[model samples]
Target: MPDEQGHPELEEIELGKVLAALADPARRRVIKQLLEDEAGAERHCTSFGLQLSKATRSHHFRVLREAGLIRQVDRGNSRMAQLRYGEIELRFPGLLELIRREKEEQASSET
Candidate 1:
């Protein structure tokens, strides 16, 4: 069950890994941006606007991809990222919704 890009598939994406990936503030921000995008729309890596250095950004993307939360593809010279919403939903049902709701609550409380 390799991804199109040849990344090895997890026999089962562990809940712990998913939780750990989401635990990072930067990765959560990336997930939030992906959730805000229209379904099926891919965002180029540059469009993320993360303030981190290029290497750090790449590391974040790698974590998310390996965690099965995102699918990335190279478009020309740029990488495009999109949430693996449907696949994740199939695997973990309300997990993403719970994360989104928590993020929304946090944002509202800060203002």
Candidate 2:
């Protein structure tokens, strides 16, 4: 949705929603995978090795979308999901970096 300024209007996505979306390890893995891909390339949700039911997978994507962390677009039979990296970085600088660092720390601790 665009405001009068012709720029994409970022709706005030709830912090709770964002946190809820990030709370799941699967969702965090999804975000980490998306971040690994270079900008401008759209990723299909099924490309990830997430062992979730179809409905659960949809729910995860929906939460991420509603939280404004990702932008999903329909491309015929497949839907493409992309990280809103630039917009999110501008809105909350260092936030994603912190999350990634935490993920790395957790992985290292488990090893």
Pairing residues by index, what is the TM-score of model 1? 0.83
lDDT of 2 by residue, 6-100 (tens): 22435565567667878777787788888888985799989877889989998888878878788888799998888888877877778777666
**What is the Cα-based TM-score of model 2?**
0.80
Q: After superposition, how far is residue 24 of candidate 1 from its true place, in Å?
A: 0.4
Indicate the worst ten consecutive residues by lDDT in candidate 1. 102-111
Report the lDDT tens digits of candidate 1 across residue range 1-111. 657663435455767878999888677777888888888789987687678899999999998888888889888998899888888887889988877766554633442
What are the Cα lDDT values of the candidates?
0.79, 0.75
- Candidate 2 — worst ten consecutive residues by lDDT sum? 2-11
Model 1: residues with Cα > 4 Å off, grouped in runs: 1-11, 104-111
- Against the true structure, candidate 2 has what lDDT? 0.75
Best by TM-score: 1
